[model samples]
Target: MKDNAPVFDALDLDRHAFFFDFDGTLAEFTDDPADVALDARLGLDLMRLLRRTGGAVAILTGRHRAEILSHIDPAIPVAGLHGAEFPGEVLAHDPARRAQFSPLLPGLSALVAAFPGTLLEEKDAGFALHWRRAPQHEQAMIAAAERALTELGPDWVIQHGKFVAELRQSGGDKGSALRRFMAEPPFAGRLPVAFGDDLNDMPMLAAARELGGLAVAMGERDLPADHRLSGPRALAEWLERGLA
Candidate 1:
């Protein structure tokens, strides 16, 4: 196990730009993603601080932009579909090259349907079959998705999350999204910091730390984070004080 430094001090907040993962970083994980709720006061406070400091804040998630927006204010910048779509910005990478990947979706749907206990979730740019409820079939579901996606060739990418397998249009990931944001105006001069707590978030965590900024991991399972918080409440408390 890697030893993470202490939670960031409030004084360090002024110099950093915060990038967060919504699902497990800001809200507790639930069996159904739809049931996760945002801390309204926390969201409002963070937004206000970002505006006041002229620091940029964005969400980099596997979820579609619209889905993320539905749960929070749409005004917040979001990199969705793992950077396949960033509103107002020309896609840093093209999705057309990955069109052939769609044909595999039906097969994926069929596989999930036959699995009996898995939940097939379709997103704007990709599909995910979650097996959190069907732990017994988790390995089989992943193996099936891997085999199917592997057959699709190198252009398609498979992202594995907590009990979920995602097949998305390729050419970018959370790392690319973070880099793209760093090249833009508001986020350009600021130091990039990110928060997340899942396998999918590893790239963003690495990206932030690579740029000499903070990467915070939430929850009990330690991966890599410059700082660690117990869970969403601890994260919120840290942010509230940091932004204060």
Candidate 2:
């Protein structure tokens, strides 16, 4: 990572498409994922950037599109479930594949029940074991997710974040999602600038840089990026500067 990065500005916005990760990037982490709220000021700035960029802004997140929509303008495009889902994209998995998760749930549920403060987040495409409030159970959570993946077979994979581990289908990832978005209207032909804060965000960050654009890492996690921001509050302030 470079110590000095160019100051973000409207000029950069004019030719670059903006991509952001939600938790820990746009909003701070909360013990309850459901309680993490987007800052109103940050939302407004994002909307303004979207408009200024001629609809070139999109959020690529591990969250479901609807969940992100609840916090921001529904008009802005969101690629959710770590790129497993997109606007107007229909996903149909084989019955056998769908049934695979069924076997994992009961065990995962039992584990969560056994550990106080740990959470199990069920998404449309996958599920995650979060130990944000129960740090001592982190290894247990990861082990459970790994076991779930093993049972699910080669079709499934694991995604690790700060205090969570997810087991989902193997095909889609943040980098692939970023490339897909950049191939479409209002996004194609524009530079890509991605902002993220966790391991899940790594692929998206690398994709942006590989595309001859910029990657802004949020907080510290040894992520490679063109620049870095302290955290979500600093990111919000950085966006404010671009608006000026």
For candidate 1, lDDT tens digit of each residue in 1-244? 3334354564254567778888878777877776778889777876876786575888898877777887777768898878777868544443664465567778777887887778778665667878877888898888987886878777667888888888775778888889888888778867788888888888888998898788888777676877887777887776676656
Off by over 4 Å in 2: 1-5
User: How well does candidate 2 score on lDDT at residue 37?
Assistant: 96
- Give the best candidate by lDDT: 2
The numbered model that scores best in TM-score is 2
Per-model TM against the reference = 0.86, 0.94
Assess the local accuracy of residue 163 in candidate 2 as a C-alpha lDDT between 0 and 100: 95
What is the lDDT of every predicted structure here? 0.77, 0.87
Kindly report which residue stretches of model 1 are placed more than 4 angstroms away from their true locations once superposed.
1-14, 90-99
Q: List the residue pairs that clash in candidate 2.
A: none
